[model samples]
Target: MKVGVLVLAFILAFFAESLPLGPLYAQLHPDFVALLILYWALSSSQVLSYFGIWLIGLVQDLVLGDLPGSQAISLVLMLALLYGWISRVRHLPSWEQLFFVFFLLLAQCLSAWLWHAWVGPIRWHSSLLLGPALGAALWPLLTYLLDQLQKHWPRRKTP
Candidate 1:
């Protein structure tokens, strides 16, 4: 059931991100997939393997028509960073947590940018910062909603 909800959320996020919001809106649009990946990495790390993270990135790449494997690599890089500090970070207050998430999102953006620059010329965009900033701003709300959803789920009894 947890897995189902997670998958559904990712699918919805992917669609939400792909919506045709025009040039300006699209530029400001947050990377929902990256947001979810960070959320789950902190909230339910056991549910997602490294390979699964990589696969999600690939799916994102395909959906967004980005260079193949670029998103996968970026996501994997974000996941690596998250794993090291998730224990301490998750215990922080929401405001502090926001900074950590923002850093992770920024790192993901930089990784993707560097990857693109490595492959070809890079056209730096304001959206690179805007998207992650928006995503970090949305983190508290997303955490609240997802926490409520998790609270509503039925728990299995331990023997």
Candidate 2:
């Protein structure tokens, strides 16, 4: 069922995102959870509610040991910004959608960076952009794979 697949995808993404890559690699690693959220948010059917996304972000914050609610705010804001034009975005070519994902990830990253800069010590560097860049680069592949998964999933029964 769609819901089952959705839950599975999110679980896998959470674990993947939480992997212990080295310090440099970790910074460069794409945020798999955020990427999955974006994919589902832009899908033909709205797969995740706003609160669900917020909860996921909060979980990410807890997992990453960041301040609670920082990621929640960022992800909810990102979904709010995209919700208005999701239909239009769903119709875009995969390449164009990649650009959108890049901007979304960039914004998410910048928002977190700003939060850290405000309340905690964080080194400002050029490499902060790498994670978003890599996320964008991986968008097409993630989309394709998820699309296939969704297509193969059994349709939910209508009551």
Candidate 3:
């Protein structure tokens, strides 16, 4: 059931990323897929393995039509760093967690941007910098909604 929810969230995020918002609004849009990956990585139970993160990144890369491995690398690296310190991060205060999430989102976006720039043409624009900030800002809301959904999910009985 948890896996089902995660898959649904990933699908929703994939479609959301492709929404036809104008250029400025699109740049400001949060990277929902990255946030979902981060959320699962930070959970008490490891819901996604390294391979799962890589697969999600690959799907994101395909959906966005970017260089094949750019997003996969960024996401896998971010998950590696988070999973390594999940014990410590899970104990931090909410505000501090948000701060950390900001940097994580920023790093993911920056890495992807760098990859794109390295392989192909991309115009310099301030909006490019807005994505991570926007994603960080949306973190609380996303967390709350996912928490509610998880709490309400039916649990299986253990024999």
RMSD of each: 2.4, 2.0, 2.1
lDDT (0-100) at residue 28 of candidate 2? 90
- Please give, for residues 42-149, the per-residue lDDT of candidate 2 as tens digits: 774645678988898999998888888878878887777677668778899777888888888888888888878888788988777999999999999898889899
Q: What's the TM-score of each model vs. the native?
A: 0.90, 0.90, 0.88
lDDT of 2: 0.83
| Model 2 / residue 17 / CA error / Å | 1.1
Q: Which digits, one per residue and each the tens of the lDDT, describe model 3 over residues 1-159? A: 287677777888899987888876678897889988887777647456778788888988899886898889899888777776778887775556777788888888878888889998887777656888888788778877888888887787899
lDDT of 3: 0.80
lDDT of 1 by residue, 31-65 (tens): 89988888887776474688988998999999988
List runs of model 1 lying over 4 Å from the truth: 45-47, 154-159
lDDT of each: 0.85, 0.83, 0.80
RMSD of 3: 2.1
Off by over 4 Å in 3: 156-159
Query: Could you arrange the candidates by TM-score from highest to lowest?
Result: 1, 2, 3
lDDT of 1: 0.85
Off by over 4 Å in 2: 155-159
